[model samples]
Target chain A: MELTAPDRHLIAALEGGLPLVARPYRELARGAGLDEAEVIDRLAAMVDGGLIKRLGVIVRHRELGYEANAMVVWDIADARVDDVGDRFGAFDFVTLCYRRPRRLPAWPYNLFCMIHGRQRQAVLARIDELGRVPGAAGAPREVLFSVRRFKQRGATRLGTAAAAEAAP
Target chain B: MTTFEKRLLDEFQRGFPLVERPFAAIADDLGVTEAEIIETLGRLRDEGMVSRVGAVFDPGAIGASTLAAMAVPPGRLDEVTALVNGFDEVNHNYEREHRINVWFVVTAPHRARLDAVIAEIGERTGLEVLDLPMQEAYHLDLGFPLQWN
Candidate 1:
């Protein structure tokens, strides 16, 4: 969906994040030069339009003691990847499941899922259980544990010009 | 965690109320004042327990993005990482235990710009960039339960 000027302003105001206060829209409205009702309506519309995935809290998993995190990649048959991905994504522990192109001769895994656990053993056991499941049984896979998080931030949007305008 | 923190993490991670006064609505449901709810969230954010209270946009929805990885030599890991992270598009960068040690996500306003950034990284780092754009997202929810042991 095409973002209007107001939508861009709203996104800019929200780039940092929603304020930790009652009537956040009121605060956002002041920045966007829109009324509180307009801010609420536009945000709701954005959510409905799929531009905004969800309006919620972003919990830091590591700080919460989910120390073991692994990005599991599978080499499922091209024909079966979709079915298998759907099944794997249904698991409560599978936080992210997606299909990406495989760079052959180097990277042969296309299907990827992220699993988080309290310990490495827990993550490994869950991966083992996942392999034994019906859809993904015997699927060739590899688990890459995250050794360090160099940088992690929310996605950048609107563009450099708009982003610069949003900066204080 | 205290009961308030626990409740905030559990209930507010997803399905947050989209209203003019969302905090007030949340306060009414949880039997707390709006000010108290706001204070708790502020503290949670300041403590780095929560990243933000906002929308998690779908990747490539408004901007183009791809997951790129590089096999940096062990010795030059730090230097190469600095080069990769120098770009604004490189948002999520991680060190994974594999031959392809460095993985990062690149995002731009358009597909062409995204490609240009990836090419620039390859030129600057002299590393073969493995650009794996998301073909399909089976499940994309970022919110998950925070289980404590």
Candidate 2:
């Protein structure tokens, strides 16, 4: 679905996030040149259409004292990848789960899940718990803990100044 | 953290009210005045604990995105990092503990735009860039409860 100009305006208004006012969407509607109802309707449709993956508060794990962010990759059987992925997703500790193509002879991980904890050992302990999940049991995996974050932000999106310069 | 702040963060990660007076609705539930709710959120944003109180778009839905990695020699890590981070398309760059040390996510409005950015990075760094696009993403709505152990 192609995004319209108004849609872009709404997205632009959302770049920094919702205003800290009671009627934030009204403020957004004003900036986007749409009424409050239309603004809410468009966003609702967008959410239903899967364009908006998540609609809520965005937290910074590091600032919240959950410093250990480990991307745990697993080499699960191809046939059971989704099943195992779902199983991994069930764990409260598994923050993000995905299935990606493996770069053969170099990288063998196809199932990746992220575990965030306040301590490295705590993250590891959760990973151990994750290992017991059905097909994930006894699976070969690797943990790539982030040493330093050079930059961390949400997706670079349309209508943002950054995206304008980056895309063009 | 105050108990109220902890509850607010834990409970409101997702399922944010999309109504016009969202903060008011939250205030009603949290037993605080609307102004207090808004003020606390403002303070959280200033402290960097709350990045935003808004929608998180599907990167590929609104545009093109990929997870790319590079194996930079330790001697030139800083230069390579700065070069990669310079691009607006490149968000969430991290140094992971592996031979493929540098990892980042690049998102753009089009596949060509994303490709060009990745290609340019490889050319400038003179290293083979691994373009690992996400094939599928699975999500679970766990509000990341603050484990106060």
Best by TM-score: 1
CA lDDT, candidate 2, residue A78: 92
Error of 1 at A11 (Å): 2.6
lDDT of 2 by residue, B1-149 (tens): 88888878888887788888999888898999999889999999899898888777765566678889899999999999999999988878999988989999898778888899999999999998888888887863335677755
Over the stretch A40-121, how does candidate 1's per-residue lDDT look in tens digits?
A: 8888888888878778888777777777889999998899889988989989999999999998889999899999888999
Which is the leading candidate under lDDT? 1
Candidate 2: regions farther than 4 A off: A1-3, A159-168, B140-142
RMSD of each: 2.8, 2.8
What TM value does model 1 have? 0.92
Looking at model 2, the pairs that clash are none
Query: What value does the interface RMSD of model 2 take?
Result: 2.4
For candidate 2, write residues A30-120 as lDDT tens digits.
Answer: 9778999989888888878877766778888888887888989899999999999888887777888988889987788899888888899
TM-score of each: 0.92, 0.89
By summed lDDT, which 10 consecutive residues of candidate 1 chain A come out lowest?
Answer: A159-168
> Would you list the clashing residue pairs of candidate 1?
none
